[model samples]
Target: MKAMVTTGARQMVVREVECPRPASGQVQVKLEYCGICGSDVHYYKDGKVGDHVLDHDIVLGHEVAGMVSEVGEGVTDLKVGDRVALEPGIACGKCIFCKSGHYNLCREMKFFADPPTPGALQEYVVHPADLCFKLPENVSSMEGALVEPLSVGLHAAGTGDVKLGQNVLILGTGCIGLVTLLACKARGAAKIVVVDLYDKRLEFAKKLGATHVINAKKEDVKKRVDEIFNGEGADVVLETAGSVITIAQTPFLTKAGGTIVIVGQSAQSEVSYNFSEVIVKELTIKSIFRYRNSYPVAIAAISSGAIDVKQIVTHEFSFEDSKMGFDTVIEDAENVVKAVIKF
Candidate 1:
């Protein structure tokens, strides 16, 4: 099978690789679509994100969906021809975190797109049958691939414990931020405000159901957030930009007693935050490391017409043009929200 391999910085070469067949308790999926995520772009361009540097050849594309072509000997639940969206992280089910139902933090996890773990960028990928989520009739393989990121939004909203009639602020209009906006609206958020410097992304956020959009490049983020909240401040502030500035302002943009959910990757730097302010406001600061026990809900939401996962995919490229697809996203950050590669 042909796979996109990142040999080095900003380099992706589509080379033939030996396709792994389904092992016992696994399923071989003939992948149809895989979303080129921001992390993939970062790895392709910067060769790293946070502390995990790319030390070897890596295949990066966790947001993937496909059709089952074969099932392993012990697999019972799924069968051949079933459409699926793979929940990329395969956790060690026996870890303390996994036993406590926080498997995303499992000490040993083989997440796709992460270095050293070959991802689903190839024509076929053999994944554990348990992690393959069956897609319904209403959802396409492309939308199915996007269930990964949508799960993050759901988890972020879940951490905030969002309820009906609660005003929410999302700091970033990137893919995760837009999905978070959709998730908040689905959960009955009273008003949604999305902040970003890019106007194109802000427009996408508005289309995804943001009540208000703020351009951090032009307006003071906190000032506009105050105006939107009637000088009181937001009930929930979700920091999804991964920028030091945005992470620092999370507390300032949120109201007393409100929760702040940190959903983006913070590039492995210890950014100074006002912990004293969090103490005084009695704010609940929740952090997310991918998602656990949320893919099914996100898939169901998209399948049932509750959330439009397909809209997030703004660009698409074939498997052979995977390099361009990944490069375009890194270079054209303003226009491309989500880019998918067709296999």
Candidate 2:
């Protein structure tokens, strides 16, 4: 098997490695596609995400989907030749959080590409059968790979409890931001407003069903959002840009008594926010850590033609050109939305 390994900051090389076989209750998948996440770019460019630094050479991919080549003992539901999407995180099933159905918050999670755990950038990956969600016949492998990120959007919108005919304000136009827009739109948001620094991304957001778009670089975000919603503010404000500024702007953009969902992960741990505005508005603020129980929802949404997950792809690269793909993501961040590596 061949894997793309990050040797150091801004360094990646293809290396021959041992192909992993599945154990009992697991399945071996012949990886077909792996999406490059923002965290992957961070690890490739800076070698760390927050405190989870890259201490050694590691495979760098998590958003993945493929066909089952072998099924281990005790794996009855899924069989060989079945296509599936692998949930990257493997949480301890015995934890209190897991028992309570909030498994995404489990403390003993071994998520793929997060430091010590090697990611699924290779040709073959063996994962637990329970974590692997079988894709519907209508879904493609590329779309399967996208289920991972789409799960985040589903979780965010679900957390905010976005209802039909409500207004939404998305504070970013990145892949995650766009997916959140799709999720909100699918939930029947009457007006979806997306804000970003790049005009191209904002245009893409419009094509993805954004009722309105704001380029923060050209105009004032808060002022434009107010104008779009006619000073009433959005019913739900989701911060997916992971910017400290956007995170702080949530309170002001959300409607009184509306919900604010912090979906982005900022690089800086601490951010200055206005608690007075939150108190005056009587707003409900919520946050998500990865996602729990969203894979099925995302897959079903895509399968039902409610969410077009495949439209998010802006670039694709062959497995051998994996380094080039990572470099394109870093250097051409504005142009490239989502880049996938095909095995």
- lDDT scores in order: 0.90, 0.94
How many backbone collisions does model 2 have? Answer: 0
Mark the regions of model 1 whose C-alpha exceeds 4 Å error after superposition.
none
Pairs in clash, predicted candidate 2: none
Model 2, residue 251: what's the lDDT? 97
Model 1: per-residue Cα lDDT at residue 321: 93
lDDT of 1 by residue, 1-343 (tens): 8888898998889888898889999999999999988888888898887777998988888889999999999999999999999999999999899999999999799899886777778899999999999999989999899999999999999888889999999999888998888899999999999999988888889888999999999999888887889887889999999989899999998899999999876765789999988988899998998989998999889978899878888899999999999878978889999999999
RMSD of each: 1.2, 0.8
- Tens-digit per-residue lDDT, 1-343, candidate 2: 8888899998988899898989999999999999999999999999888988888999999999999999999999999999999999999999899999999988999999987998999999999999999998999999999998899999999999999999999999888898899999999999999999999999999999999998888998889888988997999999999999999999999999999999998889899999999999999999988899999999999999999989999999999999999999999999998999999
Top candidate when judged by TM-score against the true structure: 2
